[model samples]
Target: MASSNWISGIVVCTLIASCLFVVAGIIGIVLGPHILQSQVEKQLPLTADSDQLDSWSTPPVPIYLQFWLWECVNVGEVLRGAKPYVVQRGPFTYLEHRTKTGVYFNDNYTVTYRQPISYTFVPEKSALPETTRITMVNTPIVTIVALLRNQSAKTQEIFNIVKNFFNETLFIDHTAREWIWGYEDPLLKAAKSLPIIKDLVPDDHFGYFYGSNATDDGLYTVFTGEDHINQLNNINKWNGISSLPYWRTPWGNQINGTDGSWFPPLIGKDLQSIRLYLYSTDICRSLYAKFEKHSSVLDIPTELFSIPAEIFLNSTLNPDNIAFGTTDSGVLDVSVCRQGAPIYISLPHLLYAADRYQSRLEGIEPDAPIHRTIFEVEPHTGLVLSAQKRLQINVFLQPEHFIDDFKYISEVVLPAIWINESTTIDQKSADDLNNQVLRFFTIVRWVSIVLIPIGIVIFIVTIVLFKKHRSREESTPLLFAEANNTIASDHDH
Candidate 1:
């Protein structure tokens, strides 16, 4: 009886252990995905306590700013009614740094921040010095002329008087620094006195990227993802406004995207079908990036997204896109957004643009491999693994019927400078992602996979052992009765 009880106890213990393991396996299989997703979501929000907040405010990734300037070579011949001959210049490279300041957490699951960015010249990366001269259009003179295109003839006459006073030529020699930073001109010196030119320039000097260093873009209110994880990093408001007044249509004005720096965790969502939105404060507009191909960074699986070339197409060729003008078939008019400046934007080397515009220039080359904007995002984490935003700045040097210098100058889209701002994840961040997130996910997955099969095997063994124990007890009952009777008789005698 003692031996039977021992065997029975072992069987019961085995059955209980198998039952517990099966329950654990079922729970893991059912709830594992949710737990992992929760963990990922926790790390994404921009809360003060979160580790990712520091990465967003002060990114560890190195950002590079590269420029290729276009120089008008035959300025004398171009002034005599000939198409301008152009030459492409060096990649004047700079290392850019950014920091977020004046952080304020809002009550409605959003945080506001002011970002200041600066750039430093990198000699090893640059092809030319800051003092390298570029022969290009006299931008202030051309800008004033284009600004007065819609003004009354009386207003034009007043501007003509100012132009004569400045005596600025259509084409002039300026250093790379002057073209990139700010250069003083006589007409812009009186910009305060002239109402027409006042809004176009921030100060007496005007350069493409001159006055932007160490300046905060604006107040940005971004989602913290407390309520919904997908909404993380999305700009709820920019400069106290939910939308911009720069573009022509309502759809164009919506400020619905992240700050182009960080993306929320995607987890198990469909990446290929989803469209990523990026809001660039510099452009005062949001661009949608569509999945182009499968890519990888730091050996992490990623999806490559690019701004659709359709966005660059004009109204007629791409009728669905109403953000740009109907006439300029290949340009993005950032004039209204840029304080009434006649600033036309395009892809570097006139890439993804109308062929006619590219054909109009002598040295401009529109190659996709070299110039397209690229964003490599890790699919599961939604982190920007690597990114390159390339753009070209062009000037509309149209012939004005009223101006004598422009009479010989034909209507042409002139390329001034092209820029490429790019960044990639550092190895340390990649290693952290692997250790913290990817390793946890792997362990959870293996637990579910191993536990289910092991639980089933243990259950099958328990059932077989239970049946054998029952059979042995049933067969021994008769033999055990006879033995018990013999023992009782002996005791009576």
Candidate 2:
């Protein structure tokens, strides 16, 4: 019975030892990866949608203006008003396909179905003369993309019909393989007019074309239907995997590195001065080339506002190879005038960030309006005029997405920075409040990290002490027995 009891105790001890080892190993293995990932995420810079401005809203223009924007406002009139003088009448007709799917008037809605432009796509091409002074272009490139995903044929037919009916048409092609005029060499010679090219073929997946005719100094951008469709469909594949929905800014940037969005209020210095000018944009380069001339007032020492950065209005600037002109076939003029200036943007960044934010929200707030403001100085006149306008997106991100976007902004795309004179205690207080919330998770993460190893050490020490105590106890009994046996032997002798 004694032997059996001893054996049972030994077994139990062995089981306990084995269990401790296993538990410790599992804890380290499971918790290590998650903790490491959290640390890595923390170290990353502010990403795409992570900034607070992602959710900021502009004051809404009245409903009457919104209707007038699409109905009566003429692009030319707006352009001329801003230009300070009227320019000659342009050649190509201008029509705004404010809707994602261009609208077409047809007899029936079935069988030979024709889907007019919806609010989904916003293409920036020269508006057709037929619709000029009547409609405004406010659609997004993606909106047009959604329209032509599976309906390429109908899109083409509509393009042809609109051209025939209006005597001139400017439609971006879903797949423009060669230049629009590349194949129709003969037609060009005989035809009296040519369509404007707004967008260029980024990839050769499929041939697509978009035409514009707004002004000579406009850009035309093109997106292949297949390429765009594939990206839209497979965007989810990029989740958690780095480097998929890549984008470039007008400044030739692979990523937009805006540390924070509390852009400094322009004062004292030339609003034209560009400091911290991203090494990517043409304007940045153009300004930098003349950096030596502005050395006196070039916000010296801090280089923040050394040179003035000029973002020209779409109508005033020449965008031949890019998008957004009516006369030129280049890039799409997705540019928007909030008050009046062109809001140069990073398309891929906007799309991915917006999409990621929207996906999480699941359609709560589905549109993000882009706003642009311009400050102009006439030579020695110091400051002349400032104008701001809005860029409307058919779909805006939800409030939740906008808030959570900081994850991407802080971690992946751009980190926050205190630029120029935009910092104050009030703003810092708000940031501090947010940081407290963020720090809670950070503290918990760190505490768990420290406790895991400490727990393991404590477990090992307890096991060692218990083993030593057991050894001492076992030896004590044997020592007592030996002493008694020795004493008894001596007595017998």
Candidate 3:
């Protein structure tokens, strides 16, 4: 009887424990995502105060600009002066300042931030000559001369007088060897001389050639197109491709896009391609005004993908062609990039230029891939982990109707220089991301595999105990009745 009672108590305890565990497992399965999402929401940039917005939304990405200037080694010596050739020069490094501002939220949960123009600072002044100083002093003089020389025949006398006045008095610094990049050729020199009776040579200053005027205020806005919780598609509407931001998710927030980073928030495991649009800078706008296309996909290890710099270099996000700033028909508009200068944009090392353009150059590593723009991204979170932004500067050299020697030279798009700005996540941030993902996976594994199995075992044990207690009770009642009958028979005798 005591044994039966003990078994009955054990059955009841086991059953209760099993029920509790099952209930806990069900709750975890149903409510786990909600709880995790709530926690993540609290840490989101949308909820951050003004002071914390910069820290939370903006990543501390370091950008390095590597300049590969084209040096004219032998001015048409090998090409027989018919075609001037240039060689690649130093990979000079410049530190670039990058940050985000003007953060605001929309009613639909999308957030937009202004990606200011990056300020380029050379840590070592000796590394590269101050292009800014030279540009400021020379551009105004060049502009005045070009405008004066474009007058009608009736104004030729006035133009000549102004040209001579400017030429005799306005002598700019020639310290930075302009001919090395084909900026100060015979045509340019003749244009500088008043006797030639032509427009002034187009300004070769960086600002004049690259449309740096728009970048003066350095304000460019970028939208994340994500909800307050770092999830994608919260807004039911899809804007045109131009409205798309620099990142997106293939998966929604709950099952995907929940990665605690700025990009790729809801990437799926099976997706092969993704596209992001970045607001083109003025320089880029000269070629193609719309947002630049940044396409990537899952083609590498998650570990490497998590490293932004590595993936950016190795992935398809790198340019495969030179049509970045050109029209679909491959026509390059020189006037759009810079007013009078026939400047063109390209990737570093002349990677995407036509064969005719690249063939004239020497010292090019045949094996070295052209444009080395790269982006390391975390697939799960769709976050950019690291990146190397690269672009090349080129000038279109054509024979001027008035210039004598330029008529013999082949018209070509000459590479001036290229730059690469690279950035990566810091060690502390990387470690934190790893830890957070690991903890999430660990908890999921424990609840589904370990905790649920333990609950099932307790339920089975409860059932066995309950059956045993019932069997003992049934047998005990029969045995008691048989004993009483035996006692009654003895009394009758």
CA lDDT, every model vs. true structure: 0.81, 0.26, 0.45
| Model 2 TM-score, all chains together | 0.25
Report the number of clashing residue pairs per model: 1, 105, 15
The better candidate by lDDT, 1 or 3, is 1
* Best of the two (1, 3) by TM-score: 1
Predicted model with the maximum TM-score: 1
Q: Candidate 2: list runs displaced more than 4 Å.
A: 1-321, 324-436
Question: Model 3 over residues 285-381: C-alpha lDDT tens digits?
Answer: 2111111233443332232221112111211333422323332221233334354545565555555445666665565542233354445555445
User: Among all windows of ten consecutive residues in candidate 3, which has the lowest summed lDDT?
Assistant: 246-255
Residue 446 in model 3: shift from native, Å? 5.0
Write model 1 residue lDDT over 1-493, tens digit each, in one string: 8987888888788877877777787777778867877777776777878887787888888999998889999888788778778888889998988989988888999999998989899989999998999999887878777777888878777777777777767888889988897788767778657776576455677889877888877888999888888898899998899978777788888987787666776556676777788887656678888888888888877788888787777787777567655545667777776656677788887787776676666777788877888898875567898999888888877777777578788777889999999999999989988897777767877887788778778879978978988897898888899999999999999
TM-score of each: 0.84, 0.25, 0.59
lDDT of 2: 0.26
Which candidate gets the maximum lDDT versus the true structure?
A: 1
Candidate 2 lDDT, tens digit per residue, 122-168? 22322233233322122222222223334455553443443345433
> Which segments of model 3 are wrong by more than 4 Å?
1-52, 56-59, 78-84, 99-218, 221-264, 268-270, 282-335, 352-354, 366-370, 379-382, 432-438, 445-449, 456-493
TM-score of 1: 0.84
